[model samples]
Target: MPSQNEPAEPLAKGIIPTAKQQFHDLFVWKQRVVITNEYGETRTEWVTPEPLQNPISLFMQLSLKGWLYFLVGLAAWTADAFDFHALSIQTYKLADHFDTTKTNISTAITLTLLLRSVGAAIFGLLGDRFGRKWPMIANMLVLGLLQIATIYCATFSQFLAVRSLFGLFMGGVYGNAIAMALENCPVAARGLMSGILQQGYALGYVLAACANLGVGGETETWKTVFWIAAGISIGVGLVRVLFPESKQFRQKADVDESVHTVSAKMFLEEARLMLTREWKMSVYCIILMTWFNYYSHTSQDSYTTFMLTQKQMPNDAASRASILMKTGACVGGTIIGYLSQWVGRRRAIVVSALMSGFLIPAWILPRSERALSATGFFMQFFVQGAWGIVPIHLNELSPPAFRSVFPGVTYQLGNMISSPSAQIVNAVAESHFVTRGGERVEAYGPTMAVATAIIALGIMVTAALGPERRGSRFELARRAGDRVEVGKDVEDVVMDAEKPATVQREKMDEIEKK
Candidate 1:
């Protein structure tokens, strides 16, 4: 150790936010793959591990049903959001009622997403501070009510105002639902499970598209879609009331009162402290990766709308495109879950994000509507579809202190970064791209392609340096200076079959490697 007066040497242990006074105490029951003793020898625990026991046992106990439940909740939440996009059509209806331009409808969805992102910050903090269930319940209830209320709007402004309000709750169910799944499930399964859960958003989008087709193209038809969403939200909310709090969050509560919890104020302060040079190295790496993955997701929103209009497609066609995108997104989620099992969620996420940046744009630029729609489906399926794995990856890596905040905040930060993306893309697609005639011939396709490349580059960067919490025992991770680690949703159980047969002792956090 260096003398007090000597400038401190960079320690092997990275990202210390004020040498945690009793940091080891925090890992009392968390899972682990391999642990270090005071003598510095690696020890592996073999006791029958269960949820809240050690990371290994916690890892083992995550059943398929648990993952399925998370998926159901996630599906309901995302589907609600997907359906809200149909409001873009309804937005025009409200405009037309007052004899306004139909184009205003397209803008409404953008405003809604912006509002939803802001709300996620508030509710995400709420999920961390309070329990995850109530916030989820509140989101579903509020979203349902808003869906019903959307039909009653008579003015374009009224429609805009209502939809914007609706957006506030758009991602509400998503954040809490993720927390619930992460907190309740085992560490190994967190990545794939979270991905499965998140696919609900994509599913909702597909379902909404089908509903739009059935409802047909009328001002009244769009109103009916909102009613359908409202009913679904209410039904899901009611079901949520019966779900229990996450077992993971509960573990933190059983600790000594003095070491029990960090206040919300302290939470924010911790996040600030987390920004120090040491932490920034790792966090920034993840942020960059996230920017790429989410860039694809957000740009897809713009691409779907742009392509349909570019095709001069009817409302029903547009609706079908939305459904196809959602289905593709679901495929993306499923693919993430399946592939992350082998490639690892972090690697898979980075790969998918980077590749989606390439493929998602392909969905838009095709010469024919059939080609465009097919590309959109595969883009979401292969590139963006793998998006579902992130929740699992993020949950496994993050410590309890930050779990509630990181994923949603990280996702939203990407959204914020991508905010100017549309305008930049619009400039490039329309005015920036030159043609012999100097006329706009639907710049949507190329814009999406460019956006895809940027997102892909982001994924590439992340793969190079992002943390790997996949299948690594959490307790051993902490002692290994892995505190800042943020794991993934695609359950990395590659080691499940490799577990060691013996153990001598357990540490503050029980970790064992096969």
Candidate 2:
């Protein structure tokens, strides 16, 4: 592979057919390079980086890449468990598998919940280190097996261990998937991309709920869902084998690693540099927004079915409510989320997060079950809408080389903050709020709303303080006006063009295949 340490020089991959010149739009606006040809001039007139001759061409470049990775991200995030409703109905049977008290079996679920953060950070690092393509593939296979392994465990300890391990693999699926989505999309498309990416979590619940309803939890084949999980993971893994490595990762790996001696000290130094006093504020904003996102999915979503049952709704009805919540989430994440791009991500986050404050308080309404479900749908659509920006917003804040670390850490940190809250809240609700014949309302519902509102405040704060990267990064920091900032070894860490490299250089072929 050739060393491309130069800022303005071009290198061609099959997608990026020619090396893009070191052109900097120093004007700090949203437009591509366009040079017009004049007919009557004796000397050809030269115009500096004006807007593109055709902007849609750039759109195509941006869209095609973003869309491809988004599809992959969807598959990676599609395994969320919504069978908590079913589990409640079939608690006795599930307890039998653990060979312990039902409470103990119930407690083991914490293992699965906590470990996913661990997986996200671990696999996220691998995505940055080796490449996004292979770790993702391997993670799928492992996660599938772990899901299947969930079925045959003879002891609660065994089940907990397997779930924790499964979470580790699933973590990779998400953290890397987010990194992949950012590398592929244009800056303009990021908010939408993040919104779309967040929808995958809701979609996973839909899949799990449908399966739970179909299986009905009574058959020996309730374990069949794991089979489905396994099959999909394996299938997706195969497809990802042919998936393109980001031109960015390949470029860096071909030359030298962006990071040397991946130690805590070096990591801190790099983090300090990235999170300058100004960037520190941005990091906090990322943390706050991420806090809501992490809690909403893990704590709130996980407990909805439990809450429905507690409220005296039938199992089927409760399951339907959870499904509807996710349905609302999918729609909200995809369509209404456009506000982030228009209002600016900061205002969009504040407005959307504040909606959680209103909707969550509604859960306390004295109302019919149907009315409660409607409010659930409303809360998910808007409160969760704020979360959709996280995927894109966080990525934009991170420089390329530290991409995997920051996203992974934020995601896990959010999970860590929220998961225990889910448990503690569950315990508190059980102790104090028992109603309807002393059967506590599902622990996830009311507590989740409260949890999310507090976290939403954090998100709002982050948005106010974080760096805004609305246009080309090169121009935003004036890095292009002077020189690219990466060290010779670090330059390749994030040099992706919105298109594939087409020159088909034999360089890095084996590295790519491996």
What lDDT tens digits, residue by residue, belong to model 1 across residues 427-490? 4555544232454465666666666776667665554444434553332211101122123111
Rate residue 416 of model 2 by lDDT. Answer: 50
Could you estimate the TM-score for every candidate?
0.71, 0.71
lDDT at residue 53 of model 2 (Cα atoms): 23
Where is the poorest 10-residue window by lDDT in model 2? 474-483
Instruction: Give the residue spans of candidate 1 off by over 4 A.
Output: 1-35, 38-72, 88-107, 249-286, 289-294, 297-299, 357-362, 420-441, 472-505, 508-514
Q: Output the TM-score of candidate 2.
A: 0.71
RMSD of 2: 11.0
In terms of lDDT, model 2 sits at 0.55
lDDT of each: 0.56, 0.55
